[model samples]
Target chain A: MASAPAGTLYRGGEGMWSWVAHRITGVAVFFFLLVHVMDTALVRVSPAAYDAVIATYKTPIVNLMEVGLVGAVLYHALNGIRIVLVDFWEPGPRHQKAMLRGILVVWLLLMIPGAYFMMIHTIEYLFGSTS
Target chain B: MSLEIADPRSPGAVPSGRARNRGNFEKYSWIFMRVSGLVLVFLVLGHLLIMNVLDGGVQRINFGFVAGRWSSPFWQTWDLLQLWLAMLHGANGMRTVINDYAEKPSTNFRLRMLLYVVTVFIIALGTLVIFTFDPNLA
Candidate 1:
């Protein structure tokens, strides 16, 4: 197969997108984990110091980022299960596209509620003070 | 497994190995992805729930909240395992991704070098922070 020339889209299907999304989500989660560790480590320093750092999480921007984090983690987890199936199950490769669709469906089901709850509070926090 | 080194450039091709351990690293890597992924489901979900959803959400969490939790060895272990598994799983997954996408060998080598350095640095720092943590440091 001839490879595409420079400055062109790969135009890959679900398989390609799956891998791409997995890589992105994995990277995002890893970065978040890095920050999370550092922040949580604050507890070892002092109560006032730790509270000062964590208190910043309540702001609207960080709250919004938390929602993104939740979405990424859920997508990664669901798609990760799909990847595991493809690796170990005999029928995995055969139904790879179908599994990808299934992963999306599951991700939506789980993420909708998670996002709703997350936003409900964040939104309140965002506007509740003004109202 | 054939006794020849399958060219690694072929997409969708699993590297076939001739020797007993020739491709076992890849095999184990695959297995690790599945195993750690499964465990991460629980650890990560539980973590998100406790951190983001439970008891007034993120607003409720603070120094006393964390110190209270980590006072027990159980929470410490929970965090430690999560740190290790997530870092390893992500690094290994990225290794495969770079192998697949980076057409140039040099690009692959350099990208992986960066990934490894960051992974090791984060893991080491995280581990030290976890183990040497003193609740009384305040």
Candidate 2:
């Protein structure tokens, strides 16, 4: 029983997640882009109106959401780089896994600094403190 | 009286060479779709809730609002991460679509090359914008 392969549990190779992430991110980014464009276009209507819309982002909940957005972008960027490598260069399967791991490490390193800065900036802006 | 192996290319039969590679690539692609899809669900929903539902809602957004937000290192980082992840993910997905559908080698090469170029351009432009955004530019 221990050795038996479960029909429901299939172990796929490394590239699978990357591919799925690609599509999901693509759709998401497209939606966000549409909204962003529309919102920015609102600037043409009136600065006051635009400022009203922008001010909504200052809420705590929205700040939290921005964190998630950061994560998505980081993951997508790192994985996209991996996919590009695999597609154009055709790296070996073993190398591909290594590459994926490498991507994750890089993401971690970059994300830490990115998050720190963003946090500091947010805190300063909301609290009216330079610290 | 015939012992001929069935040619996979016959009517209703799979094209052996093409079918084999397609099957292999697709197996990997299916796995990717599942994993990325799950992550994306979280990333996207979180984004929507924050931008549209939180605080005073969409009405509060503006240049000064953005400046206020970015003044915090938090939003800057958040926007940065969002930019990189979404762009890369979208590009990779498109790469798969191109590989699966594009027939000619040259066509595939050109299309992919263009994709890479565009992806890089956007990423660079976005990063620059985030880091260099001037909120006081009147």
Candidate 3:
């Protein structure tokens, strides 16, 4: 059953894609949260230990990954709101597709500025000293 | 042409039922998701703003910044609540996905076992980290 040539389960529609994306982002965010909590807790270990760990985040590669993290978090959160509405609102089920489109726009509006703000430092760090 | 009424309520169906042996677990989970989600919107956004967008942003984050923040009981409590709420919210959401996707009984059982174990482990570890934190540790 795991291997099929024709079809196993139907996976189509924007709603299905949204569900897939939601699950993927949800897992990504959770993994990041786990690492984040552990690192934040390092403050209690020793100031130097925490400082050294956080200093590594300033690296160009890590800074670049920050953009992806921000995107995942923003989408996960906005989609989460849509899920709540679909679960509770009277017209939610009917309007879920509309909500998806609305959230996509909202996510772009928020993330565009967010990305600019987040990446400005990295951009400077990456290209500033090449001279 | 005639049509056949397939058993849509098959055990492997998507969201076969929202209820189980647990006492209103699904209902409360639904309610919890909505309430936690609304609150999390504020808490998570405020967190992102302060930690990643504010003056100095992630660059300024270090032991001292965290030590200063955690010194206050208010911030400690806030972090603690955010930890619990976000963990539970995300874990519960994953539980729903597992239920929907794990079609085989054996697969479902093992997947849920792993999920529960990992969820409980992370929550326990995070709670311990929050409550036992010592800013003065040297």
Candidate 4:
């Protein structure tokens, strides 16, 4: 029985993938948070020190990275809610697959506008703005 | 022949129940994740909206902007709370991750110690920055 073929237990699917994604995104975001807190702490040193470092964050490459960071945060946040629902809500486990769909849909809806807003400065800086 | 039924809720199966019976620390950490996660969904999202999406986005952030924001007690409190909660939540999450993946007991202990050290350092630094911020320093 130990070495038998897979059974009814969930092996790999939407639920499993989401769980993997959650761990990856969580670790990534956690590391970013560490660096961010360090950078923000530079404000205590001197304005020159803080501004000099922050200027790099405004560069085109880093700005693009910011969008990626936002995307990761959004996914983690949405999927986190779904996880909470599955744990707390009575019907959540039964409908977890559907919740995954809802999370993806909402994530897309938010990311579209979010990415646009976050990238506006980068876009303008790269290709000269009309206004 | 006797029947051998498999227990779905075995000690190894339910991490939460296992933690609960062991001690209060792990169980509280589990509850902390859910509560802090829910609060962070709003706090972090709002922070990203204001800092990364509003106005000129990242380009407009600098010492002056940070100074202005921290000048308000409300933003200061918001940031302080964010720093503490996010740090603790992330630390606990990382602890669980290390426990799961580290095959060697020694490696797990060392990694978790490092995580705790980093977590404490960052939280202290962030809190100090927020509290001791001087608008006129610039």
Candidate 1 ranges with C-alpha deviation above 4 Å: A1-11, A129-131, B1-23, B101-107
Worst 10 residues of 3 chain A by lDDT: A1-10
Q: After superposition, how far is residue A51 of candidate 4 from its true place, in Å?
A: 0.7
Candidate 3 per-residue C-alpha lDDT over B3-44 given as tens digits, one digit per residue, 9 for 90 to 100: 856566784554344333467877899889889988888888
TM-scores of all predicted structures: 0.80, 0.48, 0.82, 0.88
User: If the candidates were sorted by their DockQ against the true structure, best first, what order would they fall in?
Assistant: 4, 1, 3, 2
Question: What would the DockQ be for model 2?
Answer: 0.09
User: Per-residue lDDT for A1-131 in model 1, tens only?
Assistant: 24545333224667778888988999888778878877776666677878888878887788888989998998899888888788789998777789989989988887777776766767775667755
Cα lDDT tens digits for candidate 2, A1-131: 34544342223445566656756756565545545544554444555666666655555566656665666666765676565556556553446778888978887886676555445546556776564
Error of 1 at A86 (Å): 2.4
Q: For residues B1-138, write the lDDT of model 1, one tens digit per residue.
A: 669765678756764553344657887888898999999999998999888876677878876677688788998899889999999998898788788899897898899999999889888887887788776775
lDDT of 3 at B90: 84
Residue pairs with clashing backbones, model 3: none
Top model by TM-score, which number? 4
Better candidate by lDDT, 2 or 3: 3
Q: Which pairs clash inside model 4? A: none
Residue B120 displacement in candidate 4 (angstroms): 0.6
lDDT for each residue of candidate 4 in A1-131, tens digit (9 for 90 to 100)? 34544432245777778999999999999999999999999998899999999999999899899999999989999999999999999998888889999999999998899889888877886897678
Error of 4 at B17 (Å): 20
Clashing pairs in 1: B3-B18
Q: What's the DockQ of model 1?
A: 0.50
Candidate 4 wrongly placed segments (more than 4 Å): A1-10, A129-131, B1-22
